[model samples]
Target: MEGATPPASATATTPDAPSARSAPAGRPAVVVLSSLVARGSVGGRAVVFALERMGFPVWFLPTVLLPWHPGHGRASRHVPPADAFAALAADLARAPWLGEVGAVLTGYFGSAEQVEAAAGLVAAIKAARPDALYLCDPVIGDQKPDGSGGLYLPEATAIAIRDRLMPLADIATPNRFEAGWLSGLPVGSTAEAIAAARALGPGTVLVTSAPAMMHRSVATLLVEATRCLQAEHPLVEGAPNGTGDLLAATFLARRLDGMTSEAALPRALGAVFEMVARSVRAGSDELVLAAEQDTILHPMAQVTVRAIATPKPRAK
Candidate 1:
């Protein structure tokens, strides 16, 4: 049957595996499980598109479907039933071509149970292909309107991500607030952010919106087992959603492309910074990812990166 046509149902069920004749040689697929919006780039759409643009085929699984981001006013939400979601995840986990997935990037979940399902799939992927990388973007909480940090998702959901997912991540991208919440340590200063990021279970943690050294600037702090790095850029007021998602996706793509964590930091940050600045200048509420595709491919924005001494633990 190598060259013969297969049955219609079998063809429908079978994944269209990548081939040297079709897909880019040596580029493995990225599986992105997160929220999906019909409008605006965020969650799975953001991750999938970023990876695809980098010439990687992406397997996208939507955790929840929305007309648009929740911030843009109340919209109809569709969260799949728990059992159905688990069944779908199990199906993917058992796929014959699962090894095609070289990395997984997960973000927002519709429910705590979905988090558990995602964890199972991650475990399965690792078991099937030990070298697979899992990048967990803990999208549980953020700073509140009252000028304080807190969890936006249900307490149980946050707990599931912290306990079940983060421990499995090779890389964790948490905004400053989520970092503080997950690490149970204050992240008000750069030192605190660096310490907390290291304490997080992942081998590498990228804390977006970390404290900046320059006035009117924001920073993305990367903490690893060996060292810590920071990438700071001027603040873009009225910046829109999807920046964090875009950053995480771009960084993962670059790392998969053979860049070191240190080497990839500025390039990924610069790309997002350029796209975000362009979007803001155009007065768009969403990232102009399509319009500024070149920026994503080759960032022209300026970003300054420096290494700081990793904070040592206090003596007992």
Candidate 2:
């Protein structure tokens, strides 16, 4: 809690007199808990950048730290001890500014214990501000090169996320593999994906890398109680990691800015698609977020959106 408190003078905001240096007024802060890569735009790095670029203040807590994404090469990983992580979570839970947090996004966890602490933090934030939204990105694994999928993290860690964090989430942004694994349903087809999404238990679920109706295209399906919407764009080969993290942050920021899920899906997908395309075109190993930041603010990428028919209940 050493740097938790701000000076009294810093607390005052001049709403009547705006200045170039003044912070954006009335924007609720978002708390992001995930992995941090020192030299990559993955995990908390991607999430924080997207939210901050959208003018939302962020309180980022890294679950693990690495020099870069593990996909690139071997790297040292650091996870805080359980006791210390829990203590830090406790501090944030009891913080005076907890009420200012409008949303919480949880991604990769270094350990099952960290997931437990994050669950507690999410509960506290909800209690402090009932309207706060929680988006859980189940970063367990993705489809492997062989077209098969499994958990990259320990099974215990994956289980902890499925059982502990997912239950508290208002929204879940899981890839096709994760959605299938978490819901214990096959997601090989659009219908199957929709069924799995409904089974996941969140009020809203976004299934990324969904089965696209059009060949050579990628789709993200936004599923809710009564409706399902799909936003699709042509696939970009060899795109870097962190699209999921970026998508979760972008969609959440749009929602907090008063956009409906229907409105947010296309915009968020467009931004992520544009970011990836731009980065790939530049032949960069990582997403060129700093160089092409304008895409995050006003993405001009074309995305096709359509409403999918919700599956009817099976008669007994």
The TM-score of predicted model 1 comes to: 0.90
lDDT for predicted candidate 2 compared with the true structure = 0.88
Per-residue CA lDDT of model 2 for 123-218, tens digit only, reads 777766778899999999889648866888999999989988887889999999999999999998999999999998899999999989898999
Ten-residue segment with the worst summed lDDT in candidate 2?
A: 1-10
* Total clashing pairs for each candidate: 0, 0
Model 2 clash pairs are none
- Cα RMSD, each candidate: 6.5, 6.5
> Mind giving the per-residue lDDT tens digits that candidate 1 earns over 1-316?
1122212222233344222112235888888999999999888778888889888888888999999998999989999999898878877776666768889999999899998888888877776566789999999988943677578779899998988888889999999999988989998799888888887889999999888889999899999877888899998998889888999999999998899999899999999989989999999999988898888889989899999887555667
TM-score of each: 0.90, 0.91
lDDT of 2 at 206: 99
lDDT for residue 35 in candidate 1, whole number 0-100: 93
